[model samples]
Target: MSTLVQLVLAMLTGGAFSTIVHAVMNRRRSNAEAAQIIAEAAASLVGPLNERLGQHEQRIQVLEAENAHKTTLLDEAIGFIRDLLAWAGRLLPGERTPDIPDTLRDELQL
Candidate 1:
């Protein structure tokens, strides 16, 4: 081959190789930057989500405490009414309030 023709061929090959390498490097850098941005977005959301979860837990505990208190009050009221029924049964045996069976009344502690 002529020297000038060989030189032109070499220049073309070098230019093509340089272009391919640059494209590969640019794609890799872009991918890395995208991954970093996603990580940052996730980190920013973590604090607010954790705080909301903690607040919900505290509210659930408060509601549970109030429900327990109400349950105790209801239990006391039921016991008082049961005692009143037992006393009435004893004091008014002749009045015929209802035909409650003796075994059932004993089971109820009446």
Candidate 2:
């Protein structure tokens, strides 16, 4: 029940109880070392993984910018085509200009 009683019982067992205690302690130490090794491995892998993620984000931003520029060029081309169609109609006889939608008129400020 008490510490002294336990020690006396262990001593009467010809040191077998001490050997079991030593094995249990050694196993606990081994498990702790294994956990430390896993933590270190995870720490070593994180830096390069984070760097790759940052590079991928930057590449995505550059692609988005290029897409936006292309979209702007296509919008300008559409406006130019609309203007050319209207001018061609004006130069002809009784040709009415194409009716532009209000959404396009507001967006292109035409």
Candidate 3:
């Protein structure tokens, strides 16, 4: 009777230990699966976001190049206007010279 009771108790203990181990393993597997799902979602987002960033960089480069071209054209136009003004100053008669009087010329040393 004593040996039979010992055997039954041993069997029950072994069964309980196996059940606990199996539950722990199942929980670990579920956690691993959840981690895999999150990693895949993050990877999927990376591709499109990287593509958009590349496109934006290219657009910025194009706009900068266009702005540089416009600035050069504007500089050239301003230089041309300055040259024309200088030429006009040399060609046109001065107001004081045309209005000078003989008496004032001798007094003012014109």
- The local lDDT score (0 to 100) that residue 14 gets in candidate 1 is 70
lDDT of 3 by residue, 1-110 (tens): 24465456558787576556566767999999999999999999999999999999999999999999999987786667556555665788462324435654443332
lDDT of 2 by residue, 1-110 (tens): 34575577588875688667667777999999999999999989998999999999999999999999999998997789777876777688488667777767765454
Instruction: Kindly indicate the candidate among 1 and 3 with the higher lDDT.
Output: 1
Q: Which parts of model 1 have CA positions greater than 4 angstroms off? A: 1-13, 92-110
lDDT of 1 at 61: 100
With a 3 Å backbone cut-off (N, CA, C), the pairs that clash in candidate 2 are none
Clashing pairs in 1: none
TM-score of each: 0.63, 0.67, 0.67
lDDT of 1 by residue, 5-93 (tens): 54575587875755565667679989999999999998889988999999999999999999999999877866776787777878997
**For each candidate, what is the lDDT?**
0.76, 0.80, 0.72
Order of the predicted models by TM-score, top scorer first: 3, 2, 1
